[model samples]
Target: MLRELASILGLFRQPPQDASGGDRTLVAQLVGLLVEVRAAARSNKDFTTADRIRDRLSQLGIVLEDRPNGTDWSWD
Candidate 1:
């Protein structure tokens, strides 16, 4: 599943392990990683790559909002 996630965004970042099935933490690691990759692309001035990543996440129902501070996302 992790390998497939790399394929999903053409980015190679491992999903954080969820210890206790919750990581004793916050959001889904995979979603977080995807957002990170998108941000990195935008930072590199690669809007095309960023857009592709955003579109892929949207396909999975993850909607992203661009903010001056950063990007936020949600889905229904």
Candidate 2:
């Protein structure tokens, strides 16, 4: 778990490489899909899924905020 956390942190330091054509759109769609997955996991009481998502996002330099009403996510 510690190693995974370290690996995820390392991923955040690197930016996505420049892509051509439809790659940008694809990336956006993928991100959206991941967000939905995270939401579903939370609804299903699958915190393992949520935590994995958060950890993965953290690797990408993304942070998740847990609020009483809902969750908010952002990247740095």
Q: Best candidate per lDDT, number?
A: 1
Single out the weakest 10-residue window by summed lDDT for candidate 1.
Answer: 11-20
In terms of TM-score, how similar is model 1 to the real structure?
Answer: 0.63
Task: List per-candidate RMSD values in Å.
Answer: 6.5, 5.9
* lDDT, candidate 2, 42-73, per-residue tens: 99999998788888777766677878776666
**TM-score of each predicted structure versus truth:** 0.63, 0.58
- In model 2, the runs with Cα more than 4 Å from the true position are 1-14, 65-72
Q: Which ten residues in a row have the lowest lDDT in candidate 2?
A: 5-14
lDDT of each: 0.67, 0.65
Clashes in each model (backbone N, CA, C under 3 Å)?
A: 0, 1
Q: How many angstroms is residue 3 displaced in model 2 relative to the true structure, after the best TM-score fit?
A: 15
